[model samples]
Target chain A: MNVFVVGVGLIGGSFAIDIKAAFNEAKIYGVDRSEDNLEEALSLGLIDYISNLDELDKADVVIIAIPVDATVEILPTILDKIDDNCLVFDAGSTKKKLCSTVEHHDKRRNYLAVHPIAGTEFSGPQAAIANLYRGKTNIICEVEKTAFKLQEKGMEIFSRLGMRIRYMDPSSHDKHIAYVSHLSHISSFMLGKTVIEKEKNERDIFDMAGSGFASTVRLAKSSPAMWAPIFKHNKENIIETLEEYIANLAQFKELIENDDFLAVYREMEDTNHIKTILKGIA
Target chain B: MNVFVVGVGLIGGSFAIDIKAAFNEAKIYGVDRSEDNLEEALSLGLIDYISNLDELDKADVVIIAIPVDATVEILPTILDKIDDNCLVFDAGSTKKKLCSTVEHHDKRRNYLAVHPIAGTEFSGPQAAIANLYRGKTNIICEVEKTAFKLQEKGMEIFSRLGMRIRYMDPSSHDKHIAYVSHLSHISSFMLGKTVIEKEKNERDIFDMAGSGFASTVRLAKSSPAMWAPIFKHNKENIIETLEEYIANLAQFKELIENDDFLAVYREMEDTNHIKTILKGIA
Candidate 1:
């Protein structure tokens, strides 16, 4: 099997690594706009060859792992180039836009839209690591849109990589993910911005920040190139969530200002149920 | 050496564990308003004996690890009950108010204002773990007000626990901590609240939430009893940070609403320097 992984950064590089390790016949080819990333992916042994979209016809599997905006731009072209038997999928964060981009394409059956819920605060091919998808949730959007055989092929790969699959429509995926994923990024980024602006003394943040602060702001280190497009593509849903988030913050702030300690305590106590909601999630 | 641990919860119990292991002659006496906590601490071997406030004069070292408001109410009495040679320190989140509460106490020389920047989202004696303070920062406020001998004793205990010391005035410590610690908690709690309210289906949060979402909401699981008083005591500083944070979020939301993707990208890119600032922090 020949795997063509475009945008050979963290997600793409990681998928290549796992596929190469899981299948003896899998030969990985890297395609990235950044020549430096392609070179680094090669040097890091994340790919067997550096190829371009022109050679995508030879691919048994094509994984689109670029920014969501870029995915929307090139997905139709990618679907046009792959063989009928080829299974093409994307690992973008926002699904509705990417799925809609190729809904009327001639080879719509060849493409699968997926958002694998896994990542760290780092980016680039160097940030890629093995077993990233192990025990992680992979949400598949519009599974009925893909060819049955291609869907089976995608499932086989996800199975080998230890991903649990949940099928949802593209619109619901985008809306729900706005709360669970995109909103988290914006909140983290703004939190980091607020702290960095207020505490000009970096040494103070260094000394005073505990594990809680680190955990809450960890996603601020995510790649802007990847996240900006996501925020843009899922604009309406994300804006809704940000509005809700800001309103919640403002209310909580008001409670504290009015010296309503009981209300503040109840607010946090009510949210403590998040522990049970997040139980068993990686 | 006799150690009286008031409020035998996560912080106090962990301190007892380390103190017991570090000094062979040290005896840990648990004092909690809740009998269940004292009983649990005894079963966990976090304390050698169960005692009361009246017996505090027998204490050679007193560790106050309760809520900030409770700490303010009882600090003076604890100082009065301790021997002149005894060392008393707190592990509260806010320092200015706590320091001010015992400012003019007759036994002020025996008290040391310290905030050990270490804790998990969980609480109670069952959440206690050994070595929680290893390689963590312990902020000391108004060290000069502490008696020379008692300061030496407190320093010895901190060294044994492998804690690095930082000295700041009470006001500055409270102000800086609001941005780093207190503000992070409110953001996380509000994020959790927003998501929980918007996504009524808990299964969706469980299935769709990723590592990033999990991390950004981790602090929302913190004990409400412990945090409400902290928000009250540090109201001004925390409200200031929240205003900045909410303003940043609102502006970012405006950028998204207007399709200003470039500004969103630049905003995240600029804050990426938090990576370097937070380098080496656990």
Candidate 2:
């Protein structure tokens, strides 16, 4: 089995690692614009050979795991090069744009839109680790558009990788992800910016930050190259969520200023329902 | 040694556990307005006996670990009842108000203003766990104001718990804590509120929410009875932090709306400096 992994970085490299481990016959091929990443992935044993789009016809499976913007730009070329029997899937954050980009392609039935909801704050081939998708949800947008045989092939791999599947339309996937995933990165980045700007003494922030602050601001360290594009491709949905978030923060600030602490307490008590929601997450 | 733990919840109950383990001769007495909490503490073995302020004369040390508003109300009364040699400290989030409330008390020298920068999202006696303070920062405000003998006694216990001490003025502690701790809680709570209000389908939030959302929103699960008082006591500092955070969010949204993703990328890249600062935190 020939598996070609484009954009040999965290998500792609992690998938390469798990696929190789699960299937003894799998020969993982790396396709990345960065020579450094390809070399690093090779040395890290995340991939067996350096390959490119021209050789994709021989590929039995291809995983496109790049920035969402790049996925929108290059997904059609990938579909053009793959054989009719080949199963091609993308692990992009925003699915609506990518699905729309390749909607009219002749090989649309060979393509599956996948988003395995897993990542760390770190990125790049060096950040890749085994079993990243274990116990993690894999959101498949427009799964019904893909050929049944390819869907079965993808499901077998997802099952072996220890991931659960959730199906939704491309539009719903983009809208919901803006709230759960994209909005979180924006919130974390802004929290980090606010603290960095206000707390002049770097030493004090370091000395005083508790686990709560650390966990809340953890996503501020995510790769800007990856997230900036996600924010762009899902701009409308993201802007809507940000407006709601800003309004919430403004209202909370007013309650504090007015000494209306009873309202403040009630607000927090209502939001504590997140505890039960979070329990169902992983 | 008789140790009195007021408001036997996460912070106070945790201290009770550590104090009992560290001091072989120590007898921990629970003091709370809630009879149910006292009963739970007794069953959990977090306290040796249910005691009250009237019995303060027997206390070798008193840890007031209730809400900050309540701490301000009762700290002076606690100081008045303790013996001259009894070391009294309060583990509240804000320090300036508590220090000022008992600033000129006759037994002021017996009181030590402490903000041990440690806790979990859970509260109450059932949430108590041993070694909660290990390797965490303990911010001691106005340490010189406490009697030298009592200071030594408090320092001895802090050392036994493996806590590192950082001396900060009460005003400075509250100001910096607003950025690091208090601001994070507000941000998390508001984030949770925004998601819950916008995502009408709770099932989508549950199935699609990733680990990033869970981590960023974890503080939303915090005890409102505890945090509402902290927000009230540290109003000025918290409001300032909230304003700055909201402004940053608005600016980022405008940049996204205008398609200035370069600026968005730069903002996140700059905030990535938090990675280095967080390395210093335990």
Candidate 3:
């Protein structure tokens, strides 16, 4: 099988690496708007060779792994042109609009809407690794819209990559993901901005940041081009998530102002439930 | 030299295990409010035996690695009871109050006010491991107030544990730490609460908490018993830092509401400087 992956950055590059390792006979073609990224992807041996996305004609499978806004514009066009037997899928975060845009296309059955819940703060083909998707969950929304055979093929690829599969409605995916994923990005970016603004003091950030600050604000370094569209497309859910995030901060603030030590302690202790949840204990 | 660590949790137990590994002749005495922790520390070979506060007379060094509120109350008492030759230090977040409360004590010269900037989200004696302190900074405050010989001993221990030491005034340490470390704890806890509160869908958290949310909210699992007092004692600085953090979030929110895509993108990209500052980027 030949796979053509556009937007050959972290996610796409990692997928390419994993696919080749899992299915040794598979050939991978890389695509990107940036020549530098394509060159890096080649040097990393992430793809068999560079191919324009126009070559989707020869692809048994074509994956769109770009930013959300770009995916909306490019996916329908790509879906329109692919061969009838070709399987198309998107690895974008906001899936509702993308699913809706392609829903009526004659070959919409050829496309699968998936979001593999995996990524690093790092980006580009340089950050790609062979097993980035291992043990992680991959959410497939509106699977019923896809041809059964295509869905089966996609599942085979995901399983080969060592991922667990989850099913959801696209709109519901956007709402839930806004709370879990988009909300995290906003919190981290704001945290970075807050510290950078605070760097007006004598100590620069390098001098002040330890592991704690580094971990909490790690996502602040994500691609603005990538995240801006997520926030834009998932605007309502993002807005709702942000309101809750800001409110929680405000409530904690009021507790601090009141010098309510017991309350502050209890609040933090209660939230320590996060440890259980993250570790899968909860 | 022999060393004693009270409250052998993540911080204390790590110090005990690492310091002994570096100095093979080191004898360690474990003391904790919990007998279970003492037993675990001994079983982990973190200490020679579980000892009492009175054991300080026999040891050359004593470390108070408990919560801030406990440290403020118990540390001075331990200092007063220890032999004049014993070197004492603390590994708590807030130092101004800890330093001030013991400023006039006769044995204050033996105590070194320290805040080692290293820890994982895990806690308890079970979390103790040697080498946790390696490659991390150990900040010592109000060193001039400490007796010269004991300060040298403390520095020797920190250096042998593979730690770099930086000195600052207690007041400055509290202010700067509030921005870097304390602020991160607040941000993470609030984020965890916000998502849990807003998203009635728990599976959303399970399915959508990619590495982004996991990293940003990592510190939310920190011990509330340990952190509550740090926030309470450093109440003023924490509140100030939080206000700054919330204000940054609000500003970003406004930029989003106004459809100022350029501003939103620019801010996120600028904050991306944290990558360079954290030594995270190549």
lDDT for position B18 in model 3? 85
DockQ, candidate 1, comes to 0.89
- The native-contact fractions of the candidates, in order shown, are 0.92, 0.89, 0.73
Looking at candidate 3 chain A, the ten consecutive residues that score lowest on lDDT are A200-209
| Predicted candidate 3 versus true structure: per-residue lDDT over B1-282, tens digit per residue | 878898899999999888887888899899999999999889988889899987678878999999988998898789878988989899998889999999899999998999888898899999987788887887889999999999889888898898878888888888888888898989999888887666545644565677788888899999888988888888889889999988888888787787787888989989888777778311
* Comparing 2 and 3 on DockQ, the stronger one: 2
What tens digits encode model 3's per-residue C-alpha lDDT throughout A77-115?
888778988998889989999988987999999999999
For each candidate in turn, the TM-score is 0.99, 0.99, 0.96
Clashes per candidate, residues 3 or more apart or on different chains: 0, 0, 0
Give the residue spans of candidate 1 off by over 4 A.
Answer: none
* Candidate 1: residue B253 lDDT (0-100): 97
The TM-score obtained by chain A of candidate 1 when compared with the true chain A: 0.98
State the lDDT of candidate 1 residue by residue for B142-208, as single tens digits.
9999999999999999999999999999999988999889989999999999999988755655688
- Give the poorly placed runs of model 3, Cα more than 4 Å off: A200-205, A280-282, B280-282
Which model, 2 or 3, shows the larger lDDT?
2
Q: Pick the candidate with the highest DockQ.
A: 1
